[model samples]
Structures are given as C-alpha cells and as structure tokens.
Target: MAASTKNVSVGTVETRGIEPVPDSERHGHAGQMFWTWFAANISILGLPLGATLVAFRGLNIWQAALVAIVGSFGSFALVGALSLAGKKGGAPALTLSRAVFGQRGNAGPTLVTWLSRVGWETITTTTAAYALLALLGVAFDVRQNSFLTVLCLLVFIACTLLISGLGHATIMWINKWATVLFGVLNLIVMGFLVATVDWSKVLEAPAGPSSGVIAGIGFIAAGTGIGWANAGADYARYLPRTIPGRRLVTASAFGAGIPLVLLISLGSLLTAGDPSLATSSDPVSAINAMLPSWMAIPYLIAAFGGLLMSNHLSTYSAGLTMITLGLRVPRAWAVVIDIVLMFLGGIYFMLIADDFYGPFSTFLTLLAVPISAWIGVIAVDMLRGRDYDPDALMDTSRTSRYWYTGGFRLPAVLAWVAAIVSGLLFTTAGTGADDVWFSGPLADTWPGVNGLGWAVSIGVGAAVYAVFGGRGPITTPASSPALEESVR
Candidate 1:
C-alpha cells in the first residue's frame, strides 16, 4: 500500500523522491491548490511589476488593472491546466517529462527548469533578506553592513531550508496558514499605502497606447506565471486523480490571480503618484519610504513572510528537479545543496552587484524562452493523452521504454530548440537602450519590441511539436498486476 499523509506530518522530512506517488498515498482536495498558489504569489514583488506597467509601459490605472487581471489570471490558468498531468501521472513535472522526452533528452529541459527554479529562489532570498534588513533598520535604527547583509542572507536561507526540507506536508500546511496570516498583514499594509495614494494624479493620468497594454500583459504573464509553469506538477502530484481538473485550474488561477490583481493595480496606482517605485534600485526601501514609521515594522514583516512563502516552494521544487537530474541524494539533501547555492547567489546580488533589476530582467527574459517552450511541449503532450510509465521513468538504461533513439525524442527536442531560436530572434534584454545585454535579429519586429518573445516562443513550440511530435503511438503504462503490486 502507498504511504499515508499521517506518516508525513509537519516537520517530518518527505522521503519520497522523483517517483510517482502511488495512488493509495494520493490524498488532497483541489481546493488546497488555491492556498498553495495564493501563498506562492503573495510576495510584494507584484508591486514592482505593476509599477513597471505604469512607469515603463506607460499605462494608466484602469489599463494597468486590466493588464494585471488578464496577465496574472490567464497565465496561471495554463499552469493549472498543465498541473492535470501531475494529477494523472502522480510525479514531479520534470519526472513525467521523461515520458515525453526520452531519459537523456529530458536532461535539457530538466536543467533549464532547475536553473529557473534556482534563479527565482535566489531572487526571493535576496528580496527577503532586504526585507529583514529594512525591518531591522525600522525597529532598531540598525544600519546595513557587509556582516549584517551576509547574516541576513543566511538567516533567510535557513528559514527557507527548514520548510522546504520538510517537503510536501509541511509546504501544504504552511501554504494555507502562512497565506492567511500574511495575507491579512499585507492587506493592512495595503490599506495604509492606499490611503497615501494621490488620487488626483491617479485619476488624471492619461491612458497609454493599446500596444502598451498588450506588452504589459505579456510582461506580467512572463514574470508571474511562466516562471512557475514547470513546477505546477510538483505540488499537484499528491492530489487524488478523481478530483475535478477544472476545479484545480480555477483554484490556482483565482488563488494567484486575486492577490496579484490587487497588488499590481495598487502598484500602478502608487506609481502614478510617485514614479520612483518603478525605478528604485532597492524596492523594499522605496516602498517603506511611502509608509508611516510605525507601519514599517509590520509591512516589512509581511514582505519577509511573503517572500519566505514563495522561496520555500521554489526551493522545494528545485530540490525535486535536482534529483530528477540524477543526483544520488535524498530530497532533503538536495534541498540543502539548493540552499547553499541560493545563499551564494543572494550574497552576490546583495553585496557584489550594483544593479538589481537589470540582471533580474535579463534573467527573466532569457530563461522565459526555454521554459515557455517546455510548457508548450508538455501542454501538447498532455493533449495527446500521454501517461507516465513508473518503472521506465526511473530506468536510465538502454532497455527502458523511454530510451528512444539513443535516449532522445527527436521531434520534441527539435521543436524545443527551434522554438527557442525563433523566439530569441525577437527577444531583447537590458536595463536601458545603452546597456543592452542581448537582442535578437528580429528584435525590431513588433512582437519583440512589444515584449512578446515569450509568447511567441510558446506558440512556435506548440505548433512545431504538435506537427511533428505526436506521430508515435502513445505509450501507455503496462497494466501488469506485478508492476502495480510493486509500486504499491
């Protein structure tokens, strides 16, 4: 029989690795997804995203709100849809990818997904550390120093490791309770911030061009959900198969969407009054400056808590992805390795780097291409009714069913590569026109200029894969009683 949730209580390390959860062990309602995604997105990062809409994209309050709604909700709905794969296969997203791409072929997407997770976690850790530093400064008049910066990074990483190392049960539990506690705190802070908004300026701001709205939506979608598309299954894998898939999708969309819409709109409103929030190198301090002195402590605390919630989930998924990459270690140990890397990354971001958003924007743009391509492939695979073979997923040898053509699925790999190349042709990343990091040949095209490269990547990946990839007969898992018995 499969293990029970009772055996995996809070604070207990989840012993399961990348293998599919046996059906008997699967237990959870789709409603839990609401809290899971809600907690993941409750971070204050949405503010800057919204601010960028107004300050950079040149959208007014109403247009920015529309962009936030469509961007945040629509993208996460796709995440919810892809999560159905996890419910069916009961494995991590990348683990299930072994079925779509052969074992060796899966390595590329796995590596890219892992890098995206680590990159996001590092950003979360750095932001959370900044929140702590700001909190200390507000409460104790303490000043930032090299020692304190490193210490704060360690402290934030330690907190992340604690929950993520505990794995699924703890993450689910924390997601629910932490979301409630921090959600209320954030609302209170938002209430204060809202009071200070210059209504006159906000109301009078002219609407930006319709093109800005399109680009703003693309930017928000890429930043908010594209980064998370690969990890959807990591959390959903434990849910029972019988749960309504649409309910899971709705829960995830609304859970993430509601807060994001509010935060992003609020960001736009705030930026309409003071554009500095969009341009500030230190967003934490910039937002703090807007609040009254006493509210600073709770506001920063809420920020820290929110970032922690997001970091733990990212770290948890990164750990699973690491193991999927053939790391011969326990999941918890994998989390430790992830934390160490995040700590190093946080140190570099805080102490070494002079610019934050520039590198972060570049990271987001460059990685979104491959990740979206993976999403495109996986989404199409799901449509074809692909199912995972438990035994084959773990077998890396030539004898495995998924070891096609020397462990590569030509159509899927080719489509992914081709889509990435095509998408990059219209992609560009940098802080400003003078500091351009990379720009593709077709970057002058409307889609590239409008920041729709990630969108184009997904469409190209899906179109190419759909045309070339599904010709092979769908490989269903064997119905052997012995195989079923072994898994149980």
Candidate 2:
C-alpha cells in the first residue's frame, strides 16, 4: 500500500515537514470561508435544545429573549477574545502547549479537545435519536426505548460515515447548502410565531424568578459555545492575515451566537401554549405541536437536516483533533473510527445514561474546568502581547519555539493541571438539599449551576499562566531549512 503524504503541522507554526496547500488545494476565499464557518459552527442545535428543556421552562418571551441575548453576546465576545489571544501568542492553543508540557504536553490538551468531540458526538447522536423518537411518537404513539435508540444510532452512524467519507471539501460544500435550508426553516418558524403568537402571552412574566437563571445562562452559554472555542482555529488557521482576522472575531461571533438564541426563543414561544410540553426533553416535540400538520413534514426535514449538519461537524472536528495528536491516520480513516466510537458510546448512553438531564449535565460539568483552562491560557497569552508570526506558528520543523526544550512547555502544563482540579471541585461540590462546598442559591435548584465552575476555571487558569508562564523566551532556529517561508 502507498503511504499517504499529507503533511501534519502543529497548530499555526511553520516548519519543514509540513507543506502549505496550493491555492487549488485550499477550500475557498474569505467570504466563502466565513460562510463555511457559519454553517459548520451552527450545528450546535442540541445545545439550545437541551438548555430550553432543562433550564428555563416558565420563562416568558422577554426573559427568554434576555437570556438568549446575554448568552449569545457572551459567547461571541469570549470566543473572539480567545481567538485573538491565540493569534497574539503564536498558535497559543494546540501549538503553544509544546513550550509548556513538551511536544508530549500537546497531547494533554489535544486529548481534552478530542474527548470533548467524543462527548459532543455522543450527545448529538443521543439527541438525534431522541428527536427521531419524538417524531415517531407524534406519528404512531410509540414510546421511546433502547430499541429506538439503537435504531437511531444506526442511522446516525450511517449518515456520519457517508458524509465524512466524501472528504473535507465535500463537508464544506454540504455545510453551505444545509445552512441555507436551516436558515429558511428558521425563518419559517419565526415567521409563524410572529404571525400567529399572542404577543401578550409571550410578554408576560414567568411563574417566578427561576433559581438558577444566571447560572443556567452560564451552562447554556458553555454548552452552546464550547465546540466553537475548541475549534475556532480550525477555520482561522487558514485565514489570510491581510483580511484582518479580528473582523472574523465579530462575524464568527454573531454568526453563531445570535442564531442560537433565536432558536431557543423560537422553541420557547412554540411551546408556550402547552405548559407541560415546554419542559419536554425533545425540542422537536415542544415546537412541533405549535405548527399545523402540513408544516410538520418540512419542519421535520429541516430539523433532521440541522441535526445531521451538527453531527457531521462534531465528527469532523474530532477527526482534525485526532490528526493533530499525531494519530498518523488518513482523515477518512479517523472519521470512520470516530463514527464507530460515537455509535458505541451512544448505545451505552441509550441504555444507561440514567436520566437524560443527569448524565448530560454531568458530562458538561466534567468538561467545564479543563476546557475553560485551555481557553483561559490562550486569552492570557494574548493579553501579554505575545507575537504570533503565522509562518512560525504553523511550522513543524524542530528549530521553532514549538520544538524548543524538546517540545515541552512547563507553563502550559501547570495551567492545565490547575484547571482540571478546579473543574473537579466545581463538578463534585455540593449535595442534594445541602451546600456541599461553595454551593450558592443557584446550585440549590439547578443541579449544574452550583460552583461557578466556568469562572473559576478560566480565572485560575489565566491568572496562573499569565503570572508564571509569560517569562519564557522565544527560541531561535539554528539549522536552517533551505526554503522560502510559506504563507497561509
């Protein structure tokens, strides 16, 4: 068998082993790329779906709107800020870790990101299965069970394999079209609500001030934006610096954050009529009841399309992260492996995730600290005014800063460890009917809101890394590679 020859670069750093894609090989220009990002990132429909079901049942439209607005704006600002930090710190994310944890240190965060992909893949598969079950229930009055779950799993795995097998370019192409279809469906639902809904009902206040409204907002924001945070660079890495990547910060932010809130709001309004249905686990069920039977077919098709789009993205990002970790596998092969794992993991969840809310919530809680730490370090690196030479950032050569100290960076390592510990505390703290440790009013009601885990993780990780990790000098190259520096 012939060896695959695709070059593997670490983060954005430049080096010899890696080769830049020819213009023909590159995906598209900036506008095209932006839309691709918009579509790819929006696959997070499950995030808002989960949030609406679990967090704010009685919230009036005003409150729902407010929550959506805050969540969207916060995510946009944070993701943009973190991306800017990565730009400043010279691939401060996946690559910069080399300076702290060693070349092997990169493995720690990569593993975290990879695990996050798996979590998302699992969650998405479950949600897709759940949504299909809801449709079945609506049609035939059948109940959800492990059998339906397994059937959905088979469908999801099949779709993932089919789409991903076509390659990255094919995925990008599908994303553009899916986004258009999704946009039309979004317009349809919102249009219906505006046309039919009683504004007075939507404007009324909820039953009472929800216990974890603020904290609930936090978890919702985290779930919605976490995937974007981990893979922001997957798109940005290809951005031409002349285009001013900062604007991308804004575009990327609004592209994702605004639409998410609107979707949640739409779900809220659509479910407002049947108060009991508002809290239903399946988002489709909650909203589908609002529309006429004629609308169901198109809406279901759109919803299923949206589900597949997002699921494909999770698998795609998982493939990229796996490759970054030096998996030495073709992307096609990596995606296949990812689909297999997602199918198997999803089956496990179907049988024993216990409560939909419980395991899903626990999964996010476990992830909160480490992911926060990773984002925090990158943000701090930007704040410190670290210089990012694009060529150097993508280089895989041994002489670059990434390869200095035998490919390990201590500051990144320490920061990661601290973040993990903080996350553990935040997840495990507090008990039922008692303040565990640092349990606040929010934690008393909302299971996931107790410890302010996200804040602690970001603050501690950033503070520790900024104060201690900033002193290292950029290593200069010695043995010269006889080639012109390739630009992205």
Candidate 3:
C-alpha cells in the first residue's frame, strides 16, 4: 500500500491488461495526480495555442493571459474531478463508458475517445518531429526532407512508444521526473522571454478581426481545456482508495492548470511583443531564437520530453480505449496498434499535409464538442453516485447491465448525437483566418457569433439525458466466465 504522506515503491508487479488496479496494488497519494496530468500537458504545442489567441484571435497579451488562466483552471478542474472516479472504480476512463453506454452501447463513446486520443497522439508526434527537425537543422545543417524528417520522427516516437507499451505505472513514473525537469526548464525559459519582451507592444496589439475574441475563447477555453477529459481517469486509476475525492480533484486541477496558464501566457507574451513570431514557419525555432545559444538546445530537448509525456499518455489511453471497444487483445498489444496508427498518421502529416497548423487546430477543435458532451454526461453520472462495478465494465454479453435496447443506451446516445450535430452546425471553425466562419443559422445573422457551440452541445446533451432518465435503464448479468477474463 502507498504511504499516507508520499508515494511508496510498488516495484514491478504490474497488473495484467485492463484489470482493475487492485487495492493491494493501489499505492499513491492523490497529489501524484498533479504531476501526472500536469506533466502530460506541459508542451510547446501550447505555445502555438497561445500565439493563436493573441495574433490570430485578436486578444491582447493581458486578455489572452486572463482567458488562459480562467479556461485552463476550469478545464483542469474538470480533469481533476473526474480523477475521483478512477480510484472509485479501478478502470480506465474509456472502460467506464460501459456504465453510461451499455456493454455494446459503449462502443460509441469508445470510438470517439479512441479516435480523438489517436489524433492527440498524432499532434504530440508531429510537435516532437518539429522540435527534432529544428534541432537537426541547426546542429547538423540538415534542413527539411521527407527521409531525414521521418528518420527523426521514427527515432523519437520509438523511444516514447516503448514506454507507452509498458503501460500505466511506468507512464506515471516518467511523468513525475519529466515534470520536475521540464517544469524547471520551462520556467527558466519563460523568465528569459519575460526579461527580453517589450510590454508596450503586448498591451497595444489589437484583436485579429470580427468574432476573433470569441474564437480565441473557444480555442483556449473549450479546445485546450478539455483535450485531456477522456484520458483524465486513465492516470488516476491507481490512486489508493484512502485518498479523498477532493484531494484527487485538487491535485489534478492544479497540477495541470498552473503550468498551462503560465506557458500559454508566455506564448501570448511573446506573440504580443513581436507580431512576427506568430507568422514564423518553424514554431520551435521561433521560440529557440529568443533563448541563449547554450540554453536553446536544452530547451528543445525539454520540449521533446514534454511531447513524449503527452504522446505516450495518449498512446496508453488509446490502448485502454481499444480494450473498451470490446477488442480481445492484451493492453500492451493494443498499445502496439496505437503506435502503428500514430506512426502512420505522423508519416502522412510530415509528408503530405499542406496546411499543418490549420488542419491540426481544426482537428483539435472538432473533438471538443463531443468530448465536452461526453464529460458532461460522465460528470452527471459521477455526481449521482460512486457506485460502479469494475468487473462488469468488460462485460459484453446481451445480459450485461449496460446493455440497453439492442446494446445501446438510447437517451445518452441520442443526447450525444444531438449535441454533436448542434456543435457542427453552429461552430465557426475552418482552415484559415479569412475563411473561418460560423455555419449555424444563428451565427449567420449575428456574424460575430463564433465560439461556445461546445457549451450548447454538452448542455443540451446533459439536460436531455437527465430528463429522459439515463439512469433508469434495467440491469442484468453476464453468463460467460471466460468472456469476463478476456476484454469485452
């Protein structure tokens, strides 16, 4: 068991694929969650997000800072609150979908989480590739090429993939050490940026165009805030039962929230000071320009480490998501599939993706709607009660309790679909600044109405589900003992 005050060494007796983190094995303070989720999010990818807010969204540095603070805090707070469920039921977040969606019904949310996390892994990989490419270009004078860039991609992703294939305990340990090192490096780098920046420009920079501020709000508040929602419980499943739910939530929120606000603000600060940095072709190199030569390489390395933290965590959760899809495979093997998919996607983006930032940003924004609604449903379920059967989560038979009308929970699915449709119709997201426009009828008239479609999606879904009695579904039991041993 974990010591009450600190994490104790559980040493190498890792559980099998998708098994509940048994009480004997559960040993860690809730505070460890702070490092887990926090470390997962502290990356240079956030820099571009901040830049988009100031340079593209028309927010001043101070306004961007305010948005980052509020958005990140609320987002991470949701992440942390969800962590309580992990310890309550020793299963991954995706696995827990069985409670909301039936055993067969769970496939819907599982697919969404799986696809989104895979997308996130792709981003993490692309960001790392960018960093390594920049580092190689500067160090060995090797500029962009499909072969050399892919080589860096494979090498860097491979290292993190190996760790990902190892699964949760290993992931948490890596995040702990990584957060300490990268956290310090990022702070020092920010200090440098702060010392060099001219605050006069930061304060004077005007907003981008019409609906810019709202778009920025949507990007940071919803887009960046809830990216980790599906995976929050993945890291928290191992926390000891002794830890209070309040601590779990607090540790998780602060762990992820603080660095996000700080780093995102620094990006805003940089872009506000020099508008040119926003348009720079190479993001890592752009930031590297501000640092001293001695510290530049180390910062890149730290940024790469941050990428691994987010990438492998996504990989790990993607594996759980696959298992949640009722796939009969070892969790490590699921991770292998995730790696292969990520590697393939990474190759495509590096080779053929013409507009990288535009597509990536859009890709990130696309999932926020579904994820927000899904989290809303989950948070509602969590608030109702702590009761859950960890073993039943993998139950896939017709008799499983989660099996509603033809293996789907009608209300939850309908709510989710309705919310997603509304979001898609109303959301003002597109390829570039000039082309970006809201599609909904409401937005058509207002013109300046761009952001917060996610709220409508999630709110409507949650409200519908509640009114329709999502919790009223009848329960049943599985008949196959062997099936219980295998993943759903």
Candidate 4:
C-alpha cells in the first residue's frame, strides 16, 4: 500500500497530500527548482508591477529595473531557504510547519496562507481569462460578452484544475516543457514590443526620490517572490535530502529572477512612454493594443499560457494548504473546492469589480504582513536545526510531539500575532487618503509611507520569536532508526 501510494509519475495523479513523502519516493535535483520557479514567473503579471513602480511610485526606468532585480532575487532566495525545510522533513511546507507552530496553533498561519493562495489563484485565473478573451477577439473577432467572459474563465479554471489536480509530478513536467514553449513565444512578442518603445521619452523621464525607489522595491518583492515564499516547500518537498541548501536557494532565485528583471524593465520602459498602461483595468487587452496586429495572436497566446502555468502551481499549493487547514477531502477534491471559489472570484472581478489594480495592490499590501510574519517564525525555526517528526506531524492529539501546551505553541503564535499587529500599524492600503480601506496609526511614519510594513513584520516576528521561543520545552526529533539513519 505504501509503495502504491508512492507511485508518483508524470501524467499520473499524485496521491500524496500533506503527508511526508517517504525516502524511497524522493527523487530530483536542485536544477529542477530553476524551471519550476521560472515557469511560475514567466507570466506578464510582472509587467504591471513594474509599471506601477513608474506610474504610482514615480520611479524612473533604471530605478524600477534595479528594484526588480533586488526585490525578486532577494525574496526568492528566502523562498529557497524555506524549501530546505521541505527537503529535510520530506513534507509539504505547512505540514512541516506543524513542528514549528504546533498542531492547533498552526491553523492561524495555515488559514492566512490558504487565503493568500486562493487570492492569487483567482487573480491569475481572471488575468488568464482576459488573455483568452483577447485572443479570441483578435483571432476570430469574437466580442467579450457576459457569456464569453464566463466561458473564458471556465476554460482557464478547467485547465488549472486539471494540471493542479494531477499534483506534483505533473506540475514539474509541465513547468519544464511549457516554460520552453511559452518562453520563446513571449520573447518574440517582447522583441516586437521593445522595438515600438519611445526611446526619447524613456530617456527624458526624471528620476524619482530615493523614497520612491525604496517603496518600489517593497512593492516588487511583495508582488513577486513574497507571495510564493510559503509555497516553496510544496514544490521542493520531493527532492532528496542530499541537495545542498544553498544550491536550492540559488536555483530558485535565478530561475525566478531572470525573467522578472527583463519583464519589469520592459514594463517600466513602456510605462515611461505611456503611463496609462499602469492604471489599465484589463491589462491583457491593454498590452495587446500595443502589439502589432500580426503579433497580437501569439502575444495573447503566450499571456494565456503563462498565466495558466502560474495559476496551476498556485492552485496546487492552495489544495495542499486547504488539506493542512483540516479540510476533510482528498487533495484533488480540495482543488475542486478551490477552483469553484476561484471561478466565483473571476466572475466578480470580470463582471462586478470597478477596478483591477486597486483591489490587487491592496490585497498584496494587506496579506504581505501576515505572510512575512510566518516567514520570520519559520526562518528562525529552520535556522535552529528543527527536524520534523513525520508521525508527530500527523498525530494531532495530545500524544503528538507538536502538541505543545494545549495544542498551541504560544511563543510562535504570540510572535506571529504581534508581528501582524505591528506590521498593520504601518500598513495603509487604498488608492489614496480618501479611499483608504484601513490605515494604521503609524501610517505617516517612513516605513508606513514607504510600504515597508512587510519588512517590519518580518523583523518583529523574528525578533519576538527569538526571545520567547526558548521559554517552553524544546522539541526534539523522534528516536526512530529510519529517521536517524536517514539524517546520518
């Protein structure tokens, strides 16, 4: 039965869920990380992020490019580091997080992570649907009515559900091959777009203040790699323990970093010429308008394919997270539930929402705080040489090693909550002062004004956990020969 369950292969549904992957099933090299991350990030979403830096943050093209490089590369490096926990423990990230946050206590971060994944999946789905709509419009002269809109969304969601429901092996396979196919198509389209850029206007744009650059970095990081930080281990959990931690980190960073920098720089340049792209409601159609008539079809195709790649990965992680949150269903069923929600979200965004960038930017800003806090706690635990006891991770009762103090790890929970509060105190999310959703008391402070709330959250979470985490009885690895020998 164990062997049958471990039979994960390309084109087959991966049966594993939040459970730790047994040693016998572990197979892969660090290099795969590059393709996984690269495929996830090749979507045109990064373009608007760059545009926002120039349009809203008042950054020049050069400054926006610099922010992209630093923010994307640095954040994914942290993702790679967190992935080490997955490799060591041989479990999904939140599953391994049980060791750090305790069984019941883990629910808070797990819930937040699940919500983040769902939010991103919905955004990706909506964006891809728009791409498909644009493609149909350009290719066959189909107009986007309500019926066509729903149809496009269903098509994208169905594709995501199929890939994500197949789980890990299938996602990895598609990541490699689809990345190659779409990467070439996107580059061709990008070449055409680049040729059309207004160079004089791009060069004449004045540089913004240093403060804008700082905010741009924060926005880029939050939008790009920070969103994926928690899900790093969901993909990496299948790798063998022998892989060096640094190698994994390097692969993830560069895999995601390479395309992001180029796309962001292009976005900045394009926005420098026409700032309207930054505030466009439908980025897919907006970008398509700039492409030559001949290139529009392929450009939209690339956009659709790229967003599909990203959505599937996010959906896959969201499924695992849902299971981790105690959802009583098979992994595939959880994916189905998530897809249903995503479908609804797509409908709302396409039919009801007044604006796209406003809600998206606010979502990123608000969610970045709790996610960063979780990262801080997990990073500290990983650095402390924590090893997950697989059996204990599954055992949710008082007998479990992870059931720290009435099923709550107070230190970690306290740290996470405190960090979230502190971070929110600095977070101000809205289009402007009049339209603010919620602004913290410290919203006028430099960190608040500059959008460094996520950074502040991480620091506070780590600092608080470091001080109080040792107060309780320290968890030790279960004394099992299989586990012992594996570590050695």
Every candidate's lDDT: 0.90, 0.59, 0.73, 0.89
Model 3, TM vs. native? 0.89
Root-mean-square deviation per candidate: 3.1, 6.0, 5.6, 2.2
Q: For model 3, where is the 10-residue window of minimal lDDT? A: 1-10
lDDT of 3 by residue, 1-488 (tens): 11112222333423356656666777778778888878877888778778878877778876787778777877787887776667767678877777776776677778988989888888778778888987787677777888888887898778776787766667778888878988887778778778768888876777555356556666776756587888777877777766767777788778877888888888888877776667765677788888887777778888888888778888888887887786677776788788888888888777877666776766776777788778777777666553556556656677666677888887777777877777666666667758663356554533226567777777777787777744532332432332222111
**What would the per-residue lDDT of candidate 2 be over residues 30-96, giving only the tens digit for each residue?**
4444454456444425334433533444456656666676766577556655554333232324544
Q: Best to worst by TM-score, what's the order?
A: 4, 1, 3, 2
Q: Tell me how candidate 2 scores on lDDT.
A: 0.59
Q: Order of all candidates by lDDT, from best down to worst?
A: 1, 4, 3, 2
Judging by lDDT, tell me the better candidate of 1 and 4.
1
* Residue-by-residue lDDT tens digits, candidate 4, 110-212: 9999999989988998999999988898889988899999999999988998899998999999999999999999899889989878999999999999999
- The Cα error of candidate 2 at residue 485, in Å, is 15
List the candidates' TM-scores in order.
0.96, 0.78, 0.89, 0.97
Off by over 4 Å in 2: 1-27, 32-34, 40-59, 81-100, 133-149, 193-201, 206-213, 270-278, 351-354, 383-407, 426-451, 471-488
Prediction 2 TM-score vs. true = 0.78
Tens-place lDDT digits, model 1, residues 1-488: 12223345778889888888888888889888899999999999999999999999999999999999999999999989888888878889999998888989999999999999999998988899999999888788899999999999999989998999999999999999999999999999999999989999999999899999999999999999899999899999988877878888999999999999999999999999999998888899999999999899999999999999999999999999999999988889999999999999999999899988888889999999999888888888877767678878888889999999999988998889888998899999987889999999999999998999988889999999999996643646464432222212
